[model samples]
Target: MRSRRARVAVIGVVVGLVTLAGGCASTDDPKANPSPPAGGIEGTVWVANEGGHSLSVIDAASSTVVTTIEGIEGPHNVQVGPDGSRVYVVSGHASTVAALDATTYRLASAAPTGASPAHVVLTPDGQRTYVTNYDAGTVSVYRPDLTPSGTIDLGGGPHGMRPSPDGSTLVVANLKAGTVDLIDTRTDRKVAAVPVGGPAVQVAVSPDSRYAYASVSRPPSVVKIDLQTRVVAGRAEVPTAPAQVYLTPDGRSLLSADQGSKDKPGTALSVIDTATMTPAGSIATGSGPHGVVIDPTGRRAWVTNVYDSTVSVIDLPTRTTVATINMGSQPNGISYAPRPPAPAEPRMSVVLPSPPAESSHGDHGGHG
Candidate 1:
C-alpha cells in the first residue's frame, strides 16, 4: 500500500505508536480439543511489534495487552511453536530471529539468520523453524533449540514460509521471482517451483490441505493453487493494494486488508466468502490497513490501521465496524490464541483409534 507525503507521515506515526505502546481459549471446548485456557492465565496472542522493536502479549479473552518484551529490532513475522513453548519473531532489519518463552514472554535465545529475515514458521512438532530471508533469497531452518539447521536456496528472494497441513512440505513465496517454492521438509530440499499471482506477499493453506493460497499485492489478487496438480486453480481480485490475507478460523472466509489510495489514505477490510471466492463486503478502517486477524469463532476480525494508529474491530455477523481502538504505532501482524474446545465425557471405548498419518508442512521490494 502507498500514499503521498501527508499519508506517509501519518503511516510513520502509526508505526511508531505500535512500537512504543507495545501491546483465549476456552474449554467447554470439545472432545480431543485442548482448551487454550487449560493453563492458569487466559490464552495469549503473541504479536511482533515491528516499529516498537518488541513483542506484545495480549490476553485473547480480555482483548487486553498483558505484557511487552523489549529489545527486538524490526521484528516482522511472529509464530508460536508447537507445544506452545516458544514464540519466534523475525527481525527484518537485524537479520536474526528471537526465541521467546511462551509463558513469560521473555527472550529465550537469538539466532543469526540470512539477510532480512521477514517471517518465521515452526514445524508441526515444533522441532524445526523456518525463517524467510527476503534479501538473501534463502530459507533458514533452525532447530527448536534455536540452532541453525541449514539453508535452502530458493531461486528468488523468499518472504513467507508456511507448512502444509500434513506437515509433509514447506511452501515458500519467492517475492521478486513470482514463484512458490515447495520444500521437502524432511530433507530440506527444494521439491518444486510453481508460478502464481504477481508479488505474492502471504501464503495460507486450506484445512483440507488440498489448496494453497497466496495473496499477491501488486495486482491485488489472491492466487489459489491446486495442491495435487501444482497449478493455478483460481484468482480473486481485491481492491487497491491488498496487504495481509487472513483465513477465518472456521476456514469459510478470506479477509484482505486494502490500504487505500493516496488522497483518502486509510483502508477497507474486504471479506471474501471462500465458497465462491467472491468478496462479500468491506469495512472502512483507519488509513493503511496493514495486518488482520479473526477471532476463533470467526465472529469478529481485528485490523491494524498503520497510518491511523488504531485498530478497527469488525463484527463479522453484522459485517460492520463496531469499534476502533487506538493501538499506537504501526501494528504489522495479528493473531489470536484460539481456546481449545471443551472436553467431553469419556464413554466406553468401542475400539482403539488408529494413529493418523503424519503430515508435513515472499517478496518484494521497496515501500511501493
Candidate 2:
C-alpha cells in the first residue's frame, strides 16, 4: 500500500492530466478574467477548502468565485438552510460548527462539538441541525441558535449524515463500524442499524425518502436501504473506492464519486439508475472528486476535485462537463444555496403626451 504522501503524489499527477483534458488551462495574467462582484450571487456554490482553511463561494451562473471566507479551520462539510437564509459549516480541526449569515457571510453563532466533526445536515423545517462527530462516535444535534439540543451515541466513526426528505429520520454512515444507523427525529433515538459490507462513507436519500443509497469503500459498491423496512434492499456495482453518493433532485439517478483504489484512483463519476438499480453511465471528472451537488434548476451538477483544486460543472441533460472552475487547495465539501432573487428592476415612469384630444373637426374649424 502507498503511504499517504505517496498517494498525494499520485493524485497530483492525475490532477495535471485533469487540467489538460478538462481545459482548466491556467494563466498568470490576472486581467484575463476579472473578479466577480463582492455580493454573493443567488444560487451560489459554497465549497469547503480544507487545505486552505477557507470557504469559497462561487457564482453558479457565471462560473466564477464570488468570494473566499477565511479563518475556518478544516471545514469538512457545509449545508445551507432550506430558505437560504443561513449557512452552516463543520470544522473538523476546530471541533465546532459555525453558523453564518447567508447574505453577509458573517459569523452568526457557533456550537461546540466532539472531536473531528465530519459532516452536517439541517432538518427540513430548518429548526435543527445535526452534525456527525467522527472521532467521538456520536451525532450532535443543535438548534437554530447553535445551541446544543441533544446527542445520539452511535457506532465508531459516524462520518457522513443526511436527514430524510420529510425530516422524520436521519441516516448516518459509520466508517469504522461498517454500519448505517437510522435515527428517529421525533424520538431523537436510533431506530435501526443496518450492517453494510464495510466502511460506509456517505449516503444519499431518495426523493420520496423511501430509500437511502450508501457508498461502501471496502468492497466498492453502493448499497440501497429501504427506509421503511430498515433493511438492505439492494446494491449497485460502481467504480472502485466510491467516496460519495448523491441523488439527483428527481431521484431517478444516483451519482457516485469513486475515489478509485491504490492501483487506480478514480477519475470519473458513476451514474446509476435508481429504478433499475444498475450503472447507467459514467462521466469523466477530475481526480479525487469528493463532493457533488446539483443546482436548483437541476440543469447542472457541480463536483469538487480535491487534488486538482477545481470544480467540474457537468451539464445534466447532456451528461457532459461544461466548465471547470479553479479553486483553492483541496476543495472538498460543497453545497448549493439558491441565490436570492435580484431585487425587482426599479419601476420606470414615462409621461407620454396625450393624443391630440378629439380635435379633428374642431381643429379643422379653427383652421378655416
lDDT at residue 257 of model 2 (Cα atoms): 83
- lDDT score of model 2? 0.72
Q: Give the worst 10-residue stretch by lDDT in candidate 1.
A: 359-368
TM-score of each: 0.77, 0.82
lDDT of each: 0.63, 0.72
Candidate 2 runs further than 4 Å off: 1-42, 261-263, 340-368
The sequence of per-residue lDDT tens digits that candidate 2 reaches over residues 1-368 is 22222323432342211111122233211123244332223467888766666777776766666667777765768888788888888765556788877776778888777656778899999888999876567899998888899999995778788889999999998876888899999988998889997778889998898999998876778999998888888999876777778898899899998765323557889999988789999988887777898875667788977666677888888888777777766676889977742222111111112223221111000000
Residue 67 alpha-carbon offset, candidate 2, angstroms: 0.5
Predicted structure 1: clash tally: 33
lDDT against true structure, model 1: 0.63
